[model samples]
Target: MTSIIVFYLLYLLSLCLGLACVVCVCVWSGHWRGGFAWDGSALEFNWHPVLMVTGLVVVYGVGAVVYRIPLTWGQNKLPWKLLHAALMLIALILSIVGLCAVFDYHNINKISNVYSLHSWIGITATAVFAMQWVCGAAGFLLPCSPVTLRKVLKPVHVWLGGIILLLSIAACISGINEKLFFALKGNATGTQPYSSLPPEAVLGNTLGVLIVAFGLVVLKILSNHEWQRPDSRPEGLAYTPLLQEENE
Candidate 1:
């Protein structure tokens, strides 16, 4: 019960943070700037934060915890695995679209691309996630794969997933800081810089905190062995010994 409570609480917190991130980006680009667009305008840049939050933060979070839901624990694992992969694929597609938008905007404006620490880490994380998904599908989802192979790869998959999540969060933080610094730097025409705690700065900083909190809560939930889903196979199964030994 305590695990369930904590899970739901963190789930709610993630939802709130997701909403806050959307609202912050919308306010910053729509209200404060001019509005959003896809035609290489400043508004086109707004899609970056919005889609990154949706894909990396929201959808990825759901994918990470899908197997932990109690309702899914009693069901056949294949369906759950398919659902997990589908959610991750959707997240990856969203992330690709977000990346395209940013790159297009940069190209249109003649700005250099992939030049920042945030871009470097973000691209690497995306590439690693794509590779992980492909390897997972080939190893675990294929019927021809041996059970031993699956068991051996399971731990690797879980750890890589967790690491990818952390990388995504780190990229997000650095991206936010980069954007905020750029905004502050461009405010030289004004009497007061963004150091004065403008509404946009406050919203950006809050979004960063919420993102970090969401990642930490997710890590905590994932690390709790008590909340892990149990294997659905019955006793006396051929793979039972392998799983038991691995668990031990």
Candidate 2:
């Protein structure tokens, strides 16, 4: 019961942090630096951080915890799995849009793309996530997959999902830092001397902290073996033998 309570609390905290991150981005871009736009302008760049936080951090976090939700434990795993996949699919689409926004803005303005560490890591993480989703669908959702294959892929899927979550969060932090540096230095002019913190800088830093906190809480919940859902089948009839055979 305590574990369950902790789970919900952490879940709530992560969500709150996610929302805070989005709000921070909106305030930083909309209120501080004009507003967001899709056409070739600095405003178009705003969509990058906003969509990334919404899709990669918030939506992905919810999908990660879907299996751990207590209410879904008594039901068949397939429905939960489908729900998870659907959420992740939406996340993937949003992430793609975010990536495209940045690339388009850069191309239109003749700015170099994928040159920074943040861009490199973000692109790599996004690629891995896409692969993870495809592999998960093929291995688990497809009816043609054998039970042995499914058992073998389960742990890998879980671990890779966690890794991708961390990677995405790391990319977000780096991206935030990069943008803050650009803003503070006054793009192409080098006006300010990194002395004091502006409101936008403070907001960006807060967003980064919230993102890190959310990732940590979600990962803690995911890593707790005790919080894992039990099999819906009778204990004796569970797929222990199949798992063991695959392990062997």
Candidate 3:
């Protein structure tokens, strides 16, 4: 029961990260990109942006780990260990690639091709992430469940997360192979694909990037809260908190 509750909260947190990033970027874009064109120059490395991205990454990675850790103070193994592990690993990879994509565009102006890979990874990751949640909800009888429904829980979880993970890989491949934003004259001195992310995909990928990063930060905070009693989780997280806990 406790594990089930924790998983739901984790899902909420993941979603929060995604939606928050969308809002942040939309707000930032409105302010930052006015009439200004990306000039292939490196980002100025402002503290807030760095903190926002890094904090989210750490939070996400740790949460990923926590979701899959196989034991939760009982003799039995943690339920859905594989699903959690796979999802977390995928999230970590996507987050790293997202940072890379940011650099590729903001610094090298070599992102059209790079964005392909980044986009695929992100979509695939998100797909997998979403599936994980669905299976989890159904399996846990989340919100509420019938006794018979519980019988299919394990299979539902395994299958759903797995499908999402597989799709993410496909998305990853397709993303890296982008052909839509091919070469174009730079509006700001040398920015290729000056289109600033295709209108169709911009909302999805940009928001995905920011949200994943933000989610990581939130998880990291939960993991590192020192006042909470320390548990048997990992100790080396960048923003290590003793235990992963949440309510509702």
Number of the top-ranking candidate, with lDDT as the measure: 2
| Candidate 3 ranges beyond 4 A from true positions | 1-65, 70-135, 141-143, 179-248
Candidate 1 Cα errors over 4 Å, as ranges: 186-192, 234-248
Q: TM-score order of candidates, best first?
A: 2, 1, 3
Per-residue alpha-carbon lDDT of model 2 for 1-248, expressed as tens digits? 98888888888887887788788877877886679999989999888888888888888988998889886676666667778999999999889999999999999999999998898888988898999999888877665666687777889989999998988999999998888787787446543523467666777888899889989988998999977988756533343321222211
Give the per-residue lDDT of model 1 (tens digit) for 89-195: 99889888889899999999999999999999899888998998888887766666677877788899999989988998998889988887776654555524567
Clashes of each: 0, 0, 21
User: Cα lDDT of all candidates, in order?
Assistant: 0.77, 0.82, 0.43
Listed in order, each prediction's TM-score against the native is: 0.87, 0.90, 0.32
Name the candidate that leads on TM-score.
Answer: 2
Taking all chains together, the TM-score of candidate 3 against the true structure is 0.32
lDDT of 3 by residue, 27-132 (tens): 4434433322334443321222333232224333444445433234332223434444554545545444444545545556433442455555554555456556
Please report how far candidate 3 places residue 156 from its true position, in Å: 2.3
